[model samples]
Target: MNTWCVAAPLCLSVQSYADGNLTLENKGEDGKGKCPFDPFQRYASVMFENKLYSATSMNFLGSEPVLMRSSPVSIRTEFKSSWLNEPNFVSMAHMSESVMSASGDDDKVYLFFSETAVECDCYNKLLVSRVARVCKGDVGGQRTLQKKWTSFLKARIDCPVLESQLPYIIQDTYRWCDPQQPWKDCLFFAVFTPQSDTSDLSAVCVYLVSDISKVFAEGKYKTPVPVETSFVKWVMYSGDVPFPRPGACIDNSARKAGITQTLDLPDRTLQFIKDKPLMDHAIQPIGEAPLLVRRGAKFTRIIVNQVQAADGEKYHVMFIGTEEGTMLKAVNYNGEMFIIEEVQLFQPPHPIKILKFSNVTRQLYAGSDYGAAQIPLATCGRSSSCMDCVLARDPYCGWDTVGGKCIVISNSQRELIQSVKEGDASLCPGADPVKPVNQSIWLGGNVKLSCPSASNLGKTTWEQDSSPLTLSTHLQLLQDGLLIFNASHSDTGVYRCLSVERSKAGEYTTTLAEYHVSIPEGGDDRNVISPEAQINGPSLAGLQVVVGLLLVSLLALLAWNFYKGHLPLPWNYRKKNREQSQETPDQEGLNSCTTYQDAQRPALAEDKPLVSGIDNGSRNNNHTRGAAAFSAAEENDDSTFTPPSLQYIDDESEM
Candidate 1:
């Protein structure tokens, strides 16, 4: 355990715990401190032979990076830009390769990180992921490069990056050693991402331990030189190399020449290594490319587990964690990457900070800022049927015919059905029946039928009543499901979503979703235009219905006002009546008017027909007189109306 003062961020105290008690490790009896290493930077460390090997900064400011060994014999790399240039340490692993070495070599510790490139010429700084190695037997030099690693060498990882050519920064690494296999045959897996902020592309790459060793032993060295009017260039050195190799570990061949330890070596050898620690050749992945490259994901951490399947072949299953708090279970089959499944690890997602796996417990533990999660290595029970279990291509899971369930594969069980390469589930007892979802959609309504896709490699196709579903203006296929713009009677049928995947064996089809759609004979008289349609634009039928309803409403309002005696007569009829009344009337005309008024007034109380006839005759006379007066006024005016002609022009000059 350690304690730090909040007020003084630089003041740190280290302690050790044993027998339920804590003892200070860096405090002296005289009330002073003796700590040699800083623990605040993003660093990597490993324990080998009761000693700590770490790649960390030397001071509190973290400007000077170093790879060091602690305790009994304190040793580290020289403070040089060529050796370690602003390196951000990622992870470390201690591999015991001495057991299988015929040259009596010592085990080595490997460091994975990204640092400013020393071999590149650019206007701006270029970062590159590197794999550096140091022998456990390296003590230090005597004269030239004392108290520094003699076997230190680093090389760039040659895996492909994003299309934008962004640097693939190494985030985390895991060393996978196959059980009962030699250390040289083991593999090192690293997770890489292109710029933590700008790019979401991430990749998982596997490098054989043997391949990394080859580059350090046989690859050429890179020397930095200044060019004319340009940045310094790092070119391959084609000169004579020193005897016994510069960066090679002190093996039996060196002991034969009376030089074993790095301290006994001549200053010339140490000087060559210190000046040029970089290799010219880059280390390629297992397939000369990344095993998996995901465009929309950022892989934070990864752990690998090699399992023996029922087919008697061992395969590597990788459990990778992403920045979105999701875990992806993926495996490579026949050089093709297959993502088995993805599961959410945290709610209100946060980036995964740590990932660890225990072979004894067979559980994977993941940690984030908010909380931690424990997941099983194999989720066989989640695969409900034989076809699903087999098609999953998971080396850890198999379908048991007798038990009728998917179970974790074991050497003891031989009857389990699994196909890791071919993905042929034909050996199963029977096929799982497809359960169709019943859907009742109203006529002229929109519907969205969903088809869940399991893997990105699979292709989805739609079928209606065993015939291919053709896409039209009303029907469209989406990434995750199918959409119907406006359903009709012809759209009612059995729809199925089938997913097809190609493999080495052949193509396999699986039903992802099924729907039984039906429309009743006589449906409710509901509005045909849905809210979605209204947002898009109204149809012709909908517009016509709206116009008809508006016309009926206007007529009803007028009739209601007239019945209540609130409606008035037309202004033209009223004005014409007043003008005629103001004019002089002959005796005969006045007599006729008086006689008509007397007849209508007496019969209005008992005879409705006679009163209506008199009122209609008077209205017809007023309409005829108004038309004649308007015609006479137009004839008297000089600015009278004329029909338009092709040759007519408003301006006489233009004409």
Candidate 2:
């Protein structure tokens, strides 16, 4: 027996290994300790600079956003809080999707959230949407009280509104790296508005904010900024517009009467609206604000628009998740939009508060009402085929276009064949067959080849040339990994059983077992013997000749009988009668006498009794005689019966 082994490819990895099994790595559970206030609501955690940072409020009721930083390995270690009150509102309530970005000399941890006032009264009038900044150094400390977070700057304007009739609010905030300006920071935030008049008019608006620091330093806050900022609108659909309901809640009475108008708008914007210099102290009118998204439209609700790298030159991609559970992905290319992919991450109508991206591993993590989920950006990077991207294992790596290389991030086991065996014989290196078997067997005979029985070991195939043999009809796979081939010339070949294994050093080892098969010459000729040759063999020739002569004599006698018409009784009777008529006058006169008697009997029956008792008795006797005669005739007929001689001939011919 000869042995062969084939190794499995090393591209496979155990993304997640547990209890002697492996699975692809998916989103993990929240690691923070359970809070008594709200056990259902858990804060999101991220690993940055080897430290785990978690964002939470001081109390469940408080809106102050605070960060707790600690080593990921030590969960109980002290966590430091970072943030300070700013010129504007400094309240934070469960900060949505926080991410860190380093620009120039400053490393900024950008926190995206829709600013909310704890007081319901203030919340209704003032909705602050902001991107908070924290330096990298603040998160490195281990003390909670020592760490201080400061609000660097806030958006100059509020979220846009539509018609002032519908209830519109900022739903969630998503931060992504700008594709066009990869080196510079870009943010995409989604605003969700509810439709008051129609259910279909709800909408989501996406605003692209770039170089947030410039917006703060330029005093855009003092300007009368456009209520409808440079934002893209996704509207909710209503079957019809010009809403029919005109109730106070459905009507724009307060806004139309200028009840909530003010001059505390952005400086640049107030100059344009009022045509004169105005004091920054005056409050701006909410009705004058532009609508980000139309109310009651189809695609309404908070949703992630695009998650991408800050610098467009990098291959960084981001995915944004909305309150409605829809995910949108965007790629940055030299100041232009490259690609935008959308995925539904959650069931519809649920709220989502935050969306963040991890720069180190390029995984997009989302936070919503149901829970949090992380999707690898590389998995969604496929251009034409989605399978190749989604099936990728490594989170840190991506598909390289130039080198045609797929980067591997994690170290895991690769599948390998363990061993090959034949019955009790091991086909591996040590315990194989003592002799090289090159035996040949005729077609329709069983040929057995065995391999070791192991889970990792895959099935083996018998190849004639390079093609696999048809194993269904002519081949059987035994439970012991023995390949049994039924008799067939196609089984003639150098059959090989190959096994492959991956070593701890990441190299593949192969072993092979081979056997040479040929058709036995004598066996073929023995099975193909002709019928004539068998009959003419030395022991039977005399007997066959004797039987043949006897058959010929019988056939000649039958043919003579048929030619003489002796085999047909009717023809023979007619000939006999013709011979007698010409030769015997007494026989001819007897025939005439019988014919005359038959004609005289019919005339005598007409004179028989019509009412005599003796005649009736005679009639009954005649009826009995007639029944007997019919029975005898029926018994004499043989049409339904088969003769033994004909059955015997049929049986002999069939044999």
Candidate 3:
């Protein structure tokens, strides 16, 4: 092992901004120290025993990757082995810790990285990924590796290939840490993509902490022959190795106290680690296929979170980031990967290159070169209504009855999962149910029907007239329950958002929304309102009838009062029928054929009178002429009375 001095962060200037609880830290000035090493571009950092352990690299494309401890206090120590300087570190974790106890189990940091090497002469120079361990207390051997690592040992991380003996390339890794199983059971999942263009496939593999330890303990190794040719000179070892594994951490009860350092140890243990670093077996993914794969959208980083729901059960939640700035929240369900949601964390092309999750605070930190953002892991406040909370189906958040709000489930909630699934909504009493929306669009225009459902377990669907909707050339149904496309008259219907869930009681469907989508018959571009600015429905027909009658009564009363200028209504209100009889001269003016139509003074004459025989006798010569003159005059002007002059004419005719 060779020693290399590490640069400090004193020269590194930090630029930061604080908004509420979120703090964004951006790299300011160059931080290289007098040691002539560049500042780290990225790091695989972890918290162990209240301290941060990081496998960091500077000018990663150029050189110099080292392991360091920071935070709580900066720059506690730095270790730079000769083998480590060229490696590209990808992931790091605290393997074991023993600061609390004096019995001395071990405190170790495990780092995973890839390096280019011509190892053992068995294989030509090639790039390989490895898992390296170092004792936390190791200062170095006095002579061989001063200020360098003594317990430094690395092994190949063999990712098995389907058709080739060569290992697949390790692209990324995520740690699955369980607080319930501290030292015994921690595991890692690695993403491996094949080098073959024909296959062009990737897979996720799981490696147990116990399995990794066993490989270093009992596996055989390859060592170079002493007088070997340059090529193909390495063979399996046949000699006795050192006592107590060389990779194990140096501790009080570990070796004889007199030895004190790695220099006095036998050669077998050190060479064994060097020869055989690859694990004996390769761990496969949970399912038949990889966790996820796509021809486009390369994955950038993955972090695993364990969730303890109200039901006192746990879940594995994976937040995977992509190069396109999309973060997919997924879950492992019965060996299948279910993408619950996809959130665009930033503007396109601004990828979230780094992600850190705090289990204690339930917060997620996402960072890019420009800035870092912090958001809560559980968005309890986002569930504004009870229906929204239930639909979200988030295990960490539930409706709090006493607070009348959606809040993170407290420790006392043992049946949080069960409570949410009952669908009673009694947990959030008095909250208004979500209302269905009515939408109207113009013919040949665009229409988007949104049906919101929060539960990931439910299968969301759209139905028209109780029949399932099918995607047509122009009509599309999206996973988020949005039915959108060009609107037409044929699209007028009641669209229902139905969620079907399969349970022990068989399949049940719940209708989330009933959208009445209508195309306006009024048909004009000017009449078309943007979705955001659409007007409300017209007033009720009953209200219009009441208003019309009130306006009519008002006008009729005004006309009556206008006719009687001298007379006034009671309390100055218009009085009804206050006019006297009309004057004879004014009556004569209106007596002509037009106005005399209402004058029916001779109306009695038209009846079959008691004097029906008198008219027959009028045929006699005495009064026939006079009576006939008068009757003729009456017939011509039946609306007015005949004058006395007509009577005299009748007397003269009789004489």
Among these predicted structures, which one has the highest lDDT? 1
lDDT of 3: 0.58
TM-score of 3: 0.57
How many angstroms is residue 195 displaced in model 2 relative to the true structure, after the best TM-score fit?
10
Worst 10 residues of 2 by lDDT: 416-425
lDDT of 3 by residue, 417-535 (tens): 22433433434445444476788777667767877754555688888867888779667877666655666777778788887765332455567788887766675465554443334
- Order of models, best lDDT first: 1, 3, 2
What TM-score quantifies how close candidate 1 is to the native fold? 0.69
Candidate 3 segments whose C-alpha is farther than 4 A from its true place: 1-86, 97-105, 117-126, 142-148, 158-182, 189-206, 225-235, 251-254, 266-296, 333-338, 359-361, 380-393, 398-407, 411-464, 468-508, 515-655
Q: Which ten residues in a row have the lowest lDDT in candidate 1?
A: 27-36
Between candidates 1 and 3, which one is better according to lDDT? 1
Residue by residue across 1-655, what tens digits does model 1's lDDT show?
8996432123234477789987765543321111224433577888788887877776656777888887567788888889999988899998897896899888989999999998877778888999999988888889877788888999998668646475688889899987688988889999988864666778998899999999998999999888897667899999999977898999898999999798888888888998999999999889788999987668999999888888888888999999899999998887888888889999888988889987688789999989999999888887777777888888988888777889988733557888888888776666766799998676777789999864445689999999999999999999888998778889999999998777566777889899998875453357543445556566767889999999999999999987786886588569967777776555335544445545644444343212121233343244343334334534654333332223322343321
RMSD for all candidates, in order, please.
Answer: 14.5, 25.9, 26.4
Ranking by TM-score: 1, 3, 2
lDDT of candidates 1 onward, in order: 0.80, 0.38, 0.58
Residue 575 displacement (Å), model 2: 94
Lowest lDDT 10-residue stretch of candidate 3? 604-613
